[model samples]
Target chain A: MNIIISNTAGTPIYEQIKEQIKAAIFRGELKEGELLPSIRRLARDLRISVITTMRAYNDLEQEGFVVNMQGKGCYVQSQNADLLREHKLREVEKHLHASVVAARLCELSDDELLNMLKYFMNEEDEYE
Target chain B: MNNILELNGVFKSYKTFALEDITFALPRGFVMGFIGPNGAGKTTTIKLILNMLQRNAGTIKVFGKDNIFYEQEIKEKIGVVMDNTFYVDEWSLKDIERTLKPFYKRWDSGKYNSFLSDFRLDVNKKVKEISRGMKMKLMIAIALSHEADLLILDEPTSGLDAVARNELMEILSEFIEDENKGVLFSTHVTPDLEKIADYITVINNGRILYSGIKDDLLEKYVIIRGGLDVLDDEFKTKIIGCREHNVGFDGLIDSSVLPLLPKNIITERSNLDEIIVRFNNWRENK
Candidate 1:
């Protein structure tokens, strides 16, 4: 897995790794049962601490993106459709919340905000 | 494991400045970016760690061993790249290799060749003939070729182009693939540290200003900007650095207090560069 972390980015290094790996799994870039690099190997490759890599792996496992087999290694887990849907929904909810807050700050009317959202959604769909 | 490197109540002095009660640690296999303005005792701390300079007070430990007691032993396993190129002007890369081969027990010529190729450095180029970027690359190549557990670099990217800087960062990323390896990268260049530093230690005037995981800084500090009318004396005191103009004031604030900001004020996440610049400015003003 190729991951680059920004020190200046608001996110922590471990979280960056976790998020990237999750995104890869969501995009089907990493398949189920595929062995992920060892925490040590990933740490060394990324030039980060082993603890940071381990934290990312732990987070990935907790989020069900990957499973760690003690003494063996970590591997991509079979994606749970329900869990995936829930995760995606949560992400959309977050975006909606942010958009609403931004709209409120801008003093945009509900109708105007809805129209902007719809326009963006249409653009996204077109891109897809 | 405890910290990979730790200094407890450390004190060192030069004719002009003194490091007072300095204490910090770098957890294993993590890159700790050491930052401070010039004359902030960054190099002094490094010298203490490397036993190149004696400390008047406190314990210095490397990989959990007492630094003074294990100086020779510790030196063997740690790779160091300083700001100035140490080689003679006339020496070639091959000369450097021959000179360093005996110093490191785990030195591998084959690995060195691979690094040289990776950095695209010519072995025949004299130290003085090589560009500044090439010299830094050569130092990094030599540093990584040895199976050192820790890499300590002092201002390795101070004067390189963006491309060269990124290349060095990439090489560092690749080098840390050995789980046991760690990096102590000291630089005033906050942007490069922002790219790869796992933890950051900021020092000023021979004392540690801050030390912790890079995320902590991002999550816990913010830059607030607003008109002078909106900034109260109470709020101003809480800021680490504040600059005022007739138009407005901008300052770094603790994130926890961000909620207390006046409605018109703007609060945003502060990048490493802004944080360091503000910090140094504050130090200078103080």
Candidate 2:
């Protein structure tokens, strides 16, 4: 519900919408069966094309994050054990992609980057 | 009902100006903003759609029917608001209502009264006596009361203050809730469209520069700024609307080229105004 969209983002608007909805589900911010704004309402609020919003919702449904009900609207899907695991792994994959890009940009060696990551992981464990 | 309005390869000519192969579509349940610089033929296109001016070539379709063939049928479903008042100057708000009510088959008196009250228009005030903003509100009230499927407005917000403009936009967003309705509004105010329009068609010098999803158009271009030292032939050749100042040179470039640019260059998503201005510069420079 605390969605914020940036007009200037490099990602297309529909992709942004799908990502946010997925994030909300993964973070448990959106409960199972919680109703989402109808496609037209969301499009109106965001001042975007209804077609774009429909695409986002369709993608979310395909990814098993939401379900669209005839005449009722879209709702968050109840989390499945396998789907949750896959979703978490996908999130990690995104960060891994970013990390790879950063490592390449900074010319970091594998050893140095692995050591840095391990050191940060230990630092976080100590705090916990 | 798939496309509320469609114009394909449409053309018109005058002694000094011509509209050439203009094409765009407004699907049902969306708002399309028609924008351009002055004398860009926005009004002419609106006139063509209204059948006031005849097109020399191509076709116009409204509600999936040929516009010229179904002129009267199409006109009945269209609610029009022009930049200038077309009502008699001496006619009161009630008088104007009385005159137009007989023309539409589905005119609703209750809905009409509600619109007048909602717009805070005085029934006794003559057309000439009202403020520009009030007059526009009157037009909008009348347009909505007829239960038209499409609203075609030309410069409907030209003179209104910020608050009035916002009110008008809010009303438009509400109007599209029916899903069977659509709006094609022409304006120089690109910012307003950015807030409510689903699609945008930008015209300049009687040519269509871009026409499609609003987000895609914004995504296609980027505005970049950097110190004048980096302004070289490579940058110069790629930029649109390039402007040099004492401190820096700034202009627009295709978003795809952003990754290839030097690191010192700052980039932001180009806005509608920036896009139009840069397009005009690029055309003139070419």
Question: Interface RMSDs of all predictions?
Answer: 3.5, 2.8
Candidate 1: which pairs clash? Answer: A7-B194, A44-B176, A44-B177, A45-B177
CAPRI classification of candidate 2: acceptable
Whole-model Cα lDDT per candidate?
A: 0.84, 0.88
**Individual DockQ of the candidates?**
0.39, 0.36
Which regions in candidate 1 have their CA more than 4 angstroms from the true location?
A: A1-31, A37-56, A79-82, A107-128, B284-286
Clashing pairs in 2: none
Best by lDDT: 2
Worst ten in a row by lDDT for model 2 chain B: B262-271
